[model samples]
Target chain A: MDIFNKMFGKNNVSSKTVAKERLRLVLVHDRANVSPQLLETLKEELIKVISKYTEIDNSALEVSINNSEHSVVLVANIPIRVRRSMNTVC
Target chain B: MGEVIVVTSGKGGVGKTTTTANLGTALATLGYKVVLVDTDIGLRNLDVVMGLENRIVYDIVDVVEGVCKIKQALIKDKRYGSLYLLPAAQTKDKTAINSEQMKQLCGELKKDFDYVLIDCPAGIEQGFKNAIAGADKAIIVATPEVSSVRDADRIIGLLEAAEMDSPKLVINRLRPDMVKRGDMMDIDDMIEILAIDLLGVVPEDETIVISTNRGEPAVTDKNSKAGEAYRNIARRITGENVPLMNLTIENGFFQKLKKLIGLRDS
Candidate 1:
C-alpha cells in the first residue's frame, strides 16, 4: 500500500490530517476536563473493579479516548485470562 | 446603546490587536461612532497599531482611577472623526483595573459610541478577565495551527463557563497556498474543532505588517485583501449577510492545463 500510494501519489494522510487527528484527541480530553493523571487513576480503578469478576491481564490493558464524528468514547482493551464464578470469587 | 465586543485569543501573536484596530476602523468607516479600548494595560499595542500612540495624553488607567474623564482620555483618530481610542497605560500592569471597573467603563462608553472594541491581552489571566468583563459579544482570533486552535478551544470553554454568548471566531493569517498543498489545516477543520460560528477569515498578507508599520489600519487601504476581510467582518457585525471572500489562488493557463492533464493535483 505504501509503494502503491508512493507511485500513484494518493497519500491523503497529510500533515494537516495528523494535526487534526492529534487536535481531536487532545480536545476531547481538554473539553472533558480529564487530565492524563486522572485517566491513569481511572485505569487503575477499572483494573481493580474488573479483577473481582474476571482474571484479567492488567499489564496488557489499554485505555484511551476515541473521538467519533458526533461523540467521544472512553475505550478500554483489557485482556481477559479467565472468568471467575460468583461462588468461587466469594 | 453601543455594543461592546472583546477581541481575544488565549495565545499571543495571533493578531488580536490588529483585528481590534481594523474592525474598529471599519465600523467607524461605516458611519458608526466607535471607540477602541486597550485593556492590555502594560503591554499596550492597539494604540501603536491604530497610529494613535503618540497622542495618548491619558490612558485607561487614568480614566478608571478617576485621574481623568473618559472623554479626556480618548484620542480622536486622525482620519475618522467618529473613531476614538482609549489607550492603555504603558506603565501600569493588568492589575491596575479590575473587572468591575472595566464593566463600568464599558457601560459608560456604550451610551455614547455605536461600537466599543476591547483589545484583550494574551493568556487566560487577569487581563483576559478584564477584557471580557464589559463585553456583550466576543470574537476569538486564531490562526490555522495546532497550538492556536487548541488555545482557541480553551478560550471557547472559558467563555462558555463565564456565560458569555457563544463567542464568534475569526481565523486569521490563513495561507491558502499552504492549505492547497495539504501542509496546513483548512477552514472547515478549524470550525469543526472550535465548534463556533466563524466571524471571518483573513488571509495571510504582508500588508498587515505594512499597515501596522504605517500606524494606519488595512481597512483604510483600498487594495489590501486583509483590509477587505476586516470590512466584511465589520459588515457581518452589523448583521449583514456577506458571503465569505473567495481565497482560491488564480491559476495560470499552463497550470490549469497541467491540472487538466492529471500532471498536477489541485
Candidate 2:
C-alpha cells in the first residue's frame, strides 16, 4: 500500500500548482518592494518585540510575506521556549 | 492624434518583438495606418523579424540626432501598404536617444500614423524609459514561466509608477496541451496572479518561428493559430468585444487511453 501510494499519491501536487504557489509568494514580495534584507531586519525586530513577553527559539523562527485573496499578509512563525509569569510581565 | 502603444516584457525571449510585429501587421490589415519602432538599440531584430532589414537606409538614432528626417528613416513594409517600420541603429547604444527625444519622435509619428507601436527593449533601464516616454498606452507580454511572470509583476509596478495605468497583458508562447496535463501554468493562473486586463493569449505555435524566418508576420497566414490570436488581440486593442479563443487541444485515441488510466484530466 505504501509503494502504491508512492507511485500514485493524493498528496502529489502538480508542478504548475507549485509554480503558482511560488509565483504568488514571490509577487507578494516583489509588489511590496520587500527585499530579503528588509525581511531579515523585520524578523530581528519581531524577535525583539516578542522576546519581551516570552523567550523565543530565534533559530526556528520563520518570516515571510504571503498574498491573501484581497490583501498582503505578513506571516511569522515563532517557537516559544518559555512564557513569562505575571510578576515578570510587570 | 493616433495612440502610441509600447510592447514590452521585462525579460528577453518572451516574444515582445514577435507580438509587436504580428499586432502591427494585424492592425494594418484592419485598415489602420501603423508604424513599428524598434527601440532595442545595439541589438535590433524587428527589422529582420518584419523582413525589412535590407532596406534600412536610416535608423531612429539618425532621426533623433538630426542626421536624417523621420520620413527618410521609415521603411515601407513589403506587403502591407499601411505598415511601416522604423529600424534601430546597430552601432549606437541605448544612450544615443533620451526620453525627451523619443517623446518628440512619437509626437511626429502620431500626426501621420493611426497607430504607433513601439517595440520596447527588455529590462528596466534607460532603453525602457525611452520606449515608454511618448506612449499613450503600454502592452506587457509574458510567458507562462515563473521568471517571466515575476519580471512582469515588477514591470507592472514600474509602469504604474510611471503613471501609465491599466496596462494590458499578453500571455505568449502558452502550450495548451501542457496546461491540460497540469504541467504548465494556465491562463487563469497568470491573469489571477498578474491582476491585469488580458489583451490576448498566443499559443505555442511553430508557425511563428517560420513566419519570423520568412520576414513575414503570422497574421498574414490564415491557417496559423497564432495569427488568428493576433487578429483577436488587434480587434481588442481597437475596443472591440472579441471573446478569448478556445485553447483546448482535440482529445484523440492516445488522449483517451491516458484519460482511462487516470494519467490525464477529463
Against the true structure, whose DockQ is highest? 1
Give one digit per residue, the lDDT tens place, for model 1 in B1-266. Answer: 99999999999999999999999999999999999999998899998998877888999999999999999999999697699999999997999999999999999999999999999999999999999999999999999999999999999999998999989999999998779767789999999889899999999988999999999999999999999999999999999999999998877788768765767533
Runs of candidate 1 with Cα error greater than 4 angstroms are A1-12, A68-71, A83-90, B254-266
Which residue pairs does candidate 1 place in steric collision? none
After superposing the true interface residues, what Cα RMSD does each candidate give?
0.4, 0.5
RMSD of each: 3.4, 3.3
lDDT of model 1 at position B44: 92
Worst 10 residues of 1 chain A by lDDT: A81-90
Docking class of 1: high
Candidate 2 off by > 4 Å:
A1-11, A46-55, A76-90, B257-266
lDDT of 2 by residue, A3-74 (tens): 544676645677899999988777888888898899999999999999987779999999988777788888
